[model samples]
Target: MVRKFYPEEFKADAVELYSSTPGATIKKIAADLGVHEGTLSAWLRAAGVTTVPTAAGRADGGGAGVPETPAEELERLRVENKRLRADKSLLETEREILRKAAKYFAGETTW
Candidate 1:
């Protein structure tokens, strides 16, 4: 099998992303970048950086450090809640549209 080569710029950006976000893991970043975990590790080492243990995201409920301040945490939660509400609304709208479409196609609608 032929090996795929990623751009050096992409590898650099991936390393920068890993370095900038402590809550992000190599595996996660690699998956996001469509590269292998070992490939990311190699790039990191090439840059003289040692990969640390994986850090959990907020989804995991904790990570590799102290908790955020109460206000920060609250703001984060508020943002997340707003996003979830929007998602719920979108899903409801889609469901309603699908139901109407199904009824119309089945000759149950006046139109």
Candidate 2:
């Protein structure tokens, strides 16, 4: 395997991008920049950038150092709520299809 070298400016920019983008994961940002996640993490560490830890004891990219205003928080919640509802709807449909399949297969069985 060949090792690749990135310029100092590019590394700085990548770190900045990670810090500036809200809700952006290191994995996602690294993929976008065509670099390995570990490379990006190293850049972050070299730049002395620390991620904020969430209540779940995991580092989160959201709310880097600034707290969201009430309106921003509300908007974020609304978007999350919408996504969750869509997920729930899809799961319900899948469950119904599975239930129908099970019923059909059960009826077809004979001993």
Candidate 3:
């Protein structure tokens, strides 16, 4: 991976995001910015952005951060489910392609 650099203004905007957005976490915003959560967290502290931790805060396994609202959670699950199904579809397609390729190589496939 290449070392990344971010503009100070961008960092300031990101730091302010946590305070401005309800239920928004550092990890979530960082992922949206294509940066690491830890890097964003450090920026937050350096900028003196005080964040109040909620008891429900957690890191998302596949997404960004844990959803705070019921609607948010539902949306997150729906997105993840869609992504998983798409991945499954791709894998199935790839398997079919490989199976056909194998038959062709073995002289068992008809045009």
Candidate 4:
């Protein structure tokens, strides 16, 4: 595979993006920036940024060492709750579609 070189400014921007964005993961940011997660992590480490371990057991650039203020925690939870609600709505829609399909198929049976 061919190796790609990035400019110093780009590396700095990537590190800064990881450091500044709350709830942002290195994997997500790297995928957005079209770079590998490991490359983003290296850039973060080179810039002296600390990463937090995610529940999936992977290190995410979410600024783990720093404690969040109560307001910050509340905002984070609010964002997560919104995302989960959206996911639940999507799953319910899918389940309803599947249920309709099953009913339609059951009525069309040859027996």
TM-score of each: 0.48, 0.50, 0.47, 0.55
Q: Each candidate: what lDDT? A: 0.72, 0.76, 0.71, 0.78
What TM-score quantifies how close candidate 1 is to the native fold? 0.48
Runs of candidate 2 with Cα error greater than 4 angstroms are 53-111
Candidates 2 and 3 compared: the better one by lDDT is: 2
The true-versus-predicted C-alpha distance at residue 101 of model 3, in Å, is 46
RMSD of each: 6.9, 8.1, 8.8, 6.6
Candidates arranged by lDDT, highest first: 4, 2, 1, 3
* Ranked candidates, highest TM-score first: 4, 2, 1, 3
Put down candidate 3 lDDT per residue, 1-111, tens digits, no spaces: 898889999988888776676555666788888888889878888988765444345432244444378765666566557757878999999999999998889896458
- Which lDDT tens digits does candidate 4 get at residues 9-61? 99999988877765568888899999999899888889898874444435553
Superposed Cα deviation of residue 18, candidate 3 (Å): 1.6
Clashes of each: 0, 0, 0, 0
- Candidate 3's TM-score reads 0.47
User: Per-residue CA lDDT of candidate 1, range 49-99, in tens?
Assistant: 655432233322335655567776665667657757878999999999999
Clashing residue pairs, backbone N/CA/C < 3 A, model 4 = none
